[model samples]
Target chain A: MLTNRRTLLAGAGALAAGRAFAQGTGAPIRIGLLHDLSGPFAGAGSVPLSVGAEIAIELFNERGGVDGRMVQAVAADSQSRAEVAINEAERLVSQERVDVIVGVYSSAHAVPLAQRMQAQGKILWINSAIASAVLKGKHFTHVFRPTVHSDQYGEGSIEFLAEHCERATRIAPTQFKLGIIYEDGPYGVGVATALEENARRVGMPVALKEGYSATAPDLSTLVTKLRRARPDAVLQVGYNPDITLFLRQAKAGGLRTRMLIGHGAGYSQIDRLTETFGAEIDHFCNVDPAATQMLDPSRLTPPARELQQTLLTRYHARTQSNDPPTHASMGFNNTWVFLEHVLKPAVREGGGSIDAMRRAALGVDIPVGGTIQGYGVKFNPPEHEMAGQNGRSVAVVMQFENARSKVVWPTPIAGGPPVMPLPAGSPFALR
Target chain B: MDPFLLEAIVNGILLGGVFALPVLGLNLVFGVVDVVWLCYAELVMVGMYCVWFLYTQAGWPLIAAFAACLPVVAGLGLLLHQLVVRPLLSSPPITQVLATGGVLFILQGGAMLIFGTDFRSLGVEMPPMEVGEIFVSGTKLIAFVAALVGAGLLWTFLKFTYVGTAIRAIARDREVMPLMGVDPRRIYLVASAIGGTLAGLAACLLVVQLDVHPFIGLSFGPITFMICVMGGLGNMLGGFLAAFLMGVIISTGGFWWNTEMSYVVAFACFIVVMFARPRGLFAR
Candidate 1:
């Protein structure tokens, strides 16, 4: 009862605050642009976050705005905490009174915030929260995740490895030893489940499986276990920090393995890790989403490029520095994707209600250059996944060359082709 | 003693010695002033992170990088003692604990906010100067030697120095110590300063061995606290002995069995010994 009272009072206070912001802006619609502007995840976090909101606003205005009304984004950083994210969500929905809230992230912190968004009855679109359960869960609605889940990379990675790498190049599974060292979080767990299933189905012998507690005094013990396993190619499925630790310890201990590959979610951000660790970094591959190509600015369609160009220009202007074009591009892509496919058409169809917008989103088809990851944005109602099961699988295995990851798989998207038995065949000579 | 037990014993002692390097300052302050310096572990973390940042971020020379780091961590410790511990002397002990804990929290948040939660491993180019296959990294060897020297100097200070005696006097009784013209307050202040310096040095050594974060206090504090307790609280030999014992147990135990269970086994051994002898393994 007390909780109910507090909720009511908080609701009333929020209504008053929203009235103030509405009067100040002379706009009826509100959109919350919540993000993690601080901490470790903040590095890659803002690409899908900070810039995503700006692009949506431009698109909304382009299509005569929702309800012939102007939209304002209530942008704030959640700082990667459930409590902070929840508070930010409430501030966006109740206080700022945004018509929709977007850009909550990284599974460690997004779950509770997602719950709060549902409870608060806010229209929320998640740009880049990685756990598959968010899309798969039954309770999640009014929340649309346009980001790729962890397992999406597994099918792509397994296929790439089976077809291209030395260990799996033949019909027989040769040199098929597998080892996984992951961060032991939900994101790690999701990726691990998919990798294990896919690897087994593809005929790799499981040599060792271990979960390293980040809280472990040091990872020397885990690394030692890894060294002893001597797997053909050890797949280190962890965040950047853990990957850095694994590589450093492996080098220090004189551990040798044929290769090291990252599950799509971790250890991909540091563009110069190979250079940082020297020869010890040896043959490493990261399963990363393709880098945002809109940086070229000339390849995009008119409406999309206009929004993209403005965001790229404004982002540079506002911060006096360029935010990584990838996340900012993804962020913009999420809001604009929804606007281009769902909201604009919904308004055109005179279906301004929430159900109408969702219905429009269901049938929407997106093309390449429509998103930061360059995937077509479409959804089925029951699944609500950006890429439903049996979706397109694309994992580019990028190798370190003179310290930077040079894409070397998928032949087409991977700038170079994989010539196997690895450094045995000079990978750095541009394929 | 069995040769294996003797081996275990020796290994434990060395490991504890390394563990004590980081938290020696905490023992000094509490031994003299009855203030449990909780921020001691965080000091080590900041030192580790500073080492990572200086070498990796600033691209400073290894020697110059450490020189820059030591003063920084020491300065941070001194600032903490001044801003937090000093202001709460008259308050209740709980208040003092809360204030120091707050300082720990703030340092942790500040580290996260500034440097980020990334694990920075410099892979600091240190060749393992071998000792007949019991190889040691160059940086770890330097750190181990420094821990011994630092602890020796501290042992001498507490045993022979005038301020050290006054600090001991303050530990016995605050009011009586002042009657002899020794201010208990000054003793506390000096104790904190010395503690900060030692803590700073510990941080420098740890950065060479492990990845650092604002949460590094989490790594060192509990381990060191257990070391201090296992060595018998307030007994430097006890603290020092227990730290190495815990270290060896964690290392060897982790090496042989599950790494997570190593802390459990070490703590269990410490507890059994504490029960059999109500003090520590080497009770004062």
Candidate 2:
């Protein structure tokens, strides 16, 4: 009970020791990883995407994590449903108390989830979900997407057509008749609208535009419509099931086009399409952010190149997929950028507060070819029209040749010239 | 008529042919067993998986795979009867519906565990045939012919064979047939097996057109039930006719409007039909 100097000194020393220990190894940073782990989108690319994000977190943690604070990923399955994604995201933020949330596979889910996160003032780092509407005009200070948007996808395909239509198909760009067909979902609608608008801007004639439910039992009627319209090239936007159904019906209904371009989603599953259609999809092109593995190693920065290799090796080991879908690269690259660039600096500056993270994100200005996807990182300012969107993300046009994806557009980074009019023997090819 | 409109009508008829098998199967099960196998489309999904496994994974010829699918699905139907439906036959109708709905989830989860969610296609397509101003899908044509053959064979069986006649009699009057020395239970089991065999046939046709996935049953299942109910739930001929009618409406709707709007039109037509005939179009 006596107030002795020796006892007081001992108590103070113990308190100091505990505080020092806490300061040296701070509390683990919790990241909520929301993605469609089951249901229809799981097979589409969501599973691999979530796995890729997990690998990034695991790798980061292995390297002692940001500022000696281990990153903990609280994974939740959206199940390819918007309601589920919103609920899971709410639980992740309110119950699990994650510092940041990342990885939304479907644009339909992301649109609502992003709004909910923005309203709640929680940070959301989107690794996928390419709908331009997610972050187009309504600038959310906390929501950021580093991936190419639907506008980029639409523009890339049109630009490729404009540049090479005459050389490949012997048709001038102005005379080429383009047809657009899409599933009537947020993702499909977003891309189709972009395609139509961009096509008109380039003076390209659109022969037909049709929207159908992705779950429609038969697409034969749509195929027949396409046949009647007689478009020189067709641009399709759909998920896995609808894409397969459309192709099958198109083949069966004798719908022929000089060329076909698919915008991401189902188009990224080259292996599955090949399994179903064999050489039929040989010249089918897709517009998406470059799959990290598809890029030349020399183009990426040294650190990014190493990260790319690590991601591919771990991804193949995890998924047993020799061909990594673009979604996987998106998951790994975007998450890595958030960790190495945003979270690390934010933690050092202000103990990783939400505001600190936002400042760090906006402050990022990586130049071209800085990331594994060969895209730079620079978020548009809050005052900008497309706030929270990555200003430097790029989309490339890639064509499938013998079940392998080869980048064929944006000549500087392209692996080869676009195969126009599709080589003979493709079922959809013009004779 | 516009050539494109004609093509749309032809495609609609072919689409109706695709819907016919499932409608007939559901009608048979509902008519004879007097219990709705809400998992009927799930049965077809399983059959699809079976055919896909046999042809693609096990390296069986497509025909052999189809042959194996029928018996496998038939056995599954018998198992459904023995394990699920039979136990709840004496329970309320609502209880039976719940049980079958549970089976739907079980089958879906089981398929998901076994096959994952990847959409698997049979990867078989036949070239399109050009008929004077229209293009006909070779695969749909084959499926249409096969469906007609399946319906005829089923019709012949019902009209000629003793078991089939007993089954029909039981469907007509469950109490009267038992009084006439027909065992309704035995007839129900045979009807379930026949229903499953029809589902297998439907699976064979659908696999060539649509990719097979665990949740694929959701795509066409509701429409199949709609067709069955529209035609008078237990009326096989009514269901057959209704399938064609609905198919034409959908195809023509799509031709006139857009793909998404066509479904809207079909659903609207269905609502109107239901309101006009609550007991169904051919209830008597």
Candidates in order, TM-scores: namely: 0.80, 0.94
TM-score of chain B of each: 0.86, 0.98
The candidates' DockQ values read 0.23, 0.39
Candidate 2 on B1-284: residue-level lDDT in tens? Answer: 78889999999999999999999999999999999999999999999999999998899999999999999999999999999999888899999999999999999878876787778888788878998768899999999999999999999999999999998999989889988899888998999999999999999998888899888898899999999999999999999999999999999999889888898998898889899997677788
lDDT of 2 by residue, A276-341 (tens): 888878989999998988899998899989899999998787667878888889888999999999
lDDT of 1 by residue, B177-244 (tens): 78899977778778877777777788777777666645556655877887777777666676776777
> Global lDDT of each model?
0.62, 0.87
What is the iRMSD of the candidate numbered 2? 15.9
**Model 1 chain A: ten consecutive residues of lowest lDDT:** A1-10
DockQ score, prediction 1: 0.23
